[model samples]
Target chain A: MKRIALLGMPNTGKSTFFNRLTGASARIGNWPGITVDLLSARILLGADMVEVVDLPGFYDLHGFSEDEQVVRQFLQNNPIDLLCLIINATQIDQQLPLALQLRRLGLPTVAILNMADEAEQMGIRFDAAVLTAGLDSPVCFVSAKYGHGFSEARETLRQVLERNPPTNAAIQHTEFAADEALLAEAEKLVARSVSMPRVLEHGLTERIDRIVLHPILGIPLFFLALFFLFQAVYTLGGPLQDGMTWLLTTVHDQVLAHLQPILPGWLYGLLVEGVYDGLGTVASFVPIIVLFFLGMALIEDSGYLSRIAFLMDALMAKLGLDGRGFVMLMMGFGCNVPALLGTRVMRSRSLRLLTMLIIPFSLCSARLQVFVFLTTALFSSTQAPVVLFALYVVSFLTAFGTALLFKNRLPSREPLLIELPPYRLPTFKQVILRGWHEVHHFLSRASRFIIMGVVAIWLLTHLPPGVAVGGPQSLAGIFGSWLEPLLRPIGIDQQMAVVLLFGFVAKEIVLGAMAVIYGLEGDALSHLMAQRMDWVQAFSFMLFILIYTPCLSTVATLRSESKSLVFTGVSIVWSLGLAWVISFAFYQSARLLGY
Target chain B: MSMVRLSELAIGQQGIIGDMDAEGQFRQRLQSLGFRIGKEVRLIRQALFGGPLQVRVGSVNVMLRRCDAASIQIWAER
Candidate 1:
């Protein structure tokens, strides 16, 4: 298919425009030099099916940044049919030189001034004819966020595609002596075509930034902002997850339970417990991931995400991650699944991988369920919260430990250079669409491993068909028994080892597995749990749960997001090793102290 | 023009960028990011413990480490 590459500077709403044009049809493709996947979608534009690929946004065509290299490499390597150059209307004076350079390339090009709505509000106006005439290409205004002038931009792109301008080596050879004059030409063009007030005052943004980026209050305010956001998630994710669970259970009891007689026993078990349960586990995460992405998109689109980077860069830099990596880590506290998915905000491959490696160390809410139970069982009323708080401190320390370990190894080439765009109110459409896209993204990309991993665990517990589920004779129980010798030193007895197997599938089921192991529920389960393992043993086990590898869905997400089996394996191995060492030290030390 | 490193400018101070000493990609990056020779530049704020400086050139604000900022030679207006 003929290809159109969308090129622009960062924060120009280019990706938003790409999403507007393509909807959810976008597919990710890995290129050789670039670290992140470039999204391309095939769409029919004026009866011609063309692939639109969104290139990494950068400052200059002549620059040597990684993003610039990707843009230059793509042009040199591929036979692009058209170039759709997006420019922010508000920043046209600074952005136009890149446009002038590309226009000089004589490729089939169309320029669109995106964020026209914001520009108009800021008293930035344009003479359409002058801009079009000066650029010697079709220049259209669009607010990609609000769908304003979208069809017009699309039609202009179609018209440019129809003209069939030279798709030549002009882009590959932009090294003319007169290349420096492009800026002058751009200035001349802007002078004729654009008009704006002499002193621009974004009063609201300034006022908001005064607090949001304050020297003393900034960091605390960020946490406060996040606290409120997750408060929304806590309020919303619970009921939505419960509703989802109710719907899935109703399907199981009403739909699958009836099929038990018609289907073979093996088939019935596979469908009812394996596939159905696998899907249920994956579906349960949808509400939280969607809610997270909504709040994340709001924070990002409103430009506060960069502020976070700005505020946290100094501290995060000490750990070898920048401000953006800190954002992903903070998100990991809610759930490692979406947080792993959230690493897309970082452009550098090393930075993304390093951030991802540490994110799993973040003790998420799933592990929280196990901790809450363990703390309540062992520690008294005052002690539970303290123990929980201690676990959180350890979580952060481990995250830092891993980051400090890997920062030098990966060697992040992308420094903390970031553009702090003026904050704007996030539009409802953008937030909703982002949330939907993330959920869809999770379902499509990570759900496969989630289902497969869950099914595999189901097999481990259900196999040797004659044995009862999770019985001593089953695969999971057998494996746990086999590992008991290795685990005993860490205070995780055989039964606890078996429960860890279940916890590996998901920490949510850790408590349930304990109940199943003792054949008890509610207070009875806690009672039996306490009788079997004292505080030291329980503490050791909870440590293992806290520091071990991420759950099945998270593992799937790590695999899909990193796109490297080796790195995912390394992450799993690193966390497992850390969990073992920590648990062992605590258990052995407690014994040494004669606890 | 009497020029000094951009990092030498105090917080809230203004300057006209004179020349940048960095070569190859870094120089080009700084220029293209609107730190050209005559652009009016202002140091908005510095992060704590000698962190990145929030430097505004034209209407765009970019955060960069002080080490990188030191390469940009600018005429101080403070």
Candidate 2:
């Protein structure tokens, strides 16, 4: 299939255009470097099924940033049939030079003036004919935000592809010089093709930024936004999750009942108790994940997330990290996999590594669910939120402290240089699409590990021929007993040890394992936990959970991202060690205080 | 006749970029983002506790570290 690549400077709505053309929901954030990885999908243009690749945004083809390197490497390796050079219409002067550079590569190029509606609103006019003539290519005015002029652009691409343009042989030898003369030439072309109002008009984005980025109010407002986000996650997500759990349990019960008579005893056990119960428990948390992504999508699309980088830059600088690192750390609250991937936005390798190291400390959604369930079960409604909030605060403190401790040990040489895009209210379509994209990504990536984990636990608990499930004679129980001595100092008994061992697979499964081990469900399990453990012991247990080794998927992600087995191993050791010490200290201190 | 480092420019102060004291990749990045010599720029704000300075160049708003900003000489309009 012929390949068409969408290339552009950052924040020009390139991903939106890619999504419109291909029906792929690549993230549409109003920040640079959001598209760090190459995203390709098969898109239909008229009668042809052409492959479309969305390259990460780059300011200059010659720039040496990691993002620029990725784009250059991809273009060099792939035989791109056509290049759709998307540009922000309002910022044509700055954007056109990159277009000029790309066209010089001899690719069959089409320039898309995206966000045409926003430009038009600002009284900016562009003569497409003039731009087309000047650039020696087809120029189409489009509004990826509102879905304008896409059909024309698509038809133009189809015609260009039908022509079967030869690959750019000159690309290998081409020297991209961002000289004054070249820039002036591109500027003159932009001048000839576009006109703007005599008086520049500041729009709603500027008006909002005044307050949002205001020095005193900005930091507080950022925290307030985070508070609201967590509030939504807890308030709105709880009932939805409970309802999902109920529906899944009912389905699971019916499936098991039908399979029991038809299948052998072991097979029936594996399918129903192992697979269904294991996968279903993890799957039920999808609603909460979706809600968290929706909230992040809104924040990201509105361009407030970058402002967070701006606000936190100095604070993070003290920890030898940039504001962008902090943003990635915050993303960890949703999922460590994406957060680790998000480190690609940082320009330096060491900074990326450092940020990756700190991310596991951020209390992810899985851990948050565990905290929510335990705190609510163990404490009154009034005290539960406080405990949950304290966990979050501890998570941040731990991550920051880790960064500080490792600053000198790790290489750190990236300077903070980030774009602060003007804030725009995210469209409903964009928000929902992004949210759905994250949900799909999470399910596809994490479900395998969760299922395998659940099944493995079920096997350990059910195996050994005639051994009772979760009994002392069973494999899991025996293993838990072996670990009991190690955990005794922190007040974690064998039952808690078993649950924590399974929790290494995925944090969400801890509650389910607890339910099975205790032979109780829901409130009964909570009551049982309260009876077996005091508040101090329970709090220490929760603290240990908060800092222990990350889930399997997170470790896998860290290994892949860092590309170092030693680094991944160190991460595990560090977290496990810190968790033990902290829990021991808390338990001992509380006892000494006579609480 | 006096010039000021871009970092020293007061909030809302407009200036023409006179020269950049950076080289290679760093300079290339700044230029690509419309921080080239002779371009008009305005100090939007400085972040709290000596953090990066927010600057506007043409239509793009960017945050620059104080050290990076200090290397760019700007002819401020009093």
- Maximum-DockQ candidate: 2
Interface quality of candidate 2 as DockQ: 0.35
lDDT of 2 by residue, A1-595 (tens): 7878789987777767876787633321222323233456787787978878777668888766655765776666567888889999989989888888887787888899998899999999988788998787899889997898988998999998888755643245335334334656867998999653232235766777778888899999889989999898878988998999788867756665787889999887777766666566566667888899899888877778889999999999899898988888888887888889999877777888889989999898788767776887789999999988888888998899999999888877665667887666677888899999988877775666566666677778887979987888998889989999899888898878988998888887786677556545555666888788888888999999899876888999999988999999989999999999999999989999997
Model 1: per-residue Cα lDDT over A509-558, one tens digit each = 66545544454444455677778889999888988999998687788888
The residue ranges of model 2 lying beyond 4 angstroms of the native Cα positions read: A1-201, A249-268
* Residue A165 C-alpha lDDT in model 2: 54
Name the regions of candidate 1 deviating beyond 4 angstroms. Answer: A1-201, A242-270, A273-286, A331-357, A362-392, A405-415, A444-447, A493-542, A551-572, A586-595
Candidate 1 docking DockQ: 0.33
> Looking at candidate 2, what is the lDDT of residue A452?
64
Clash totals, every prediction: 0, 0
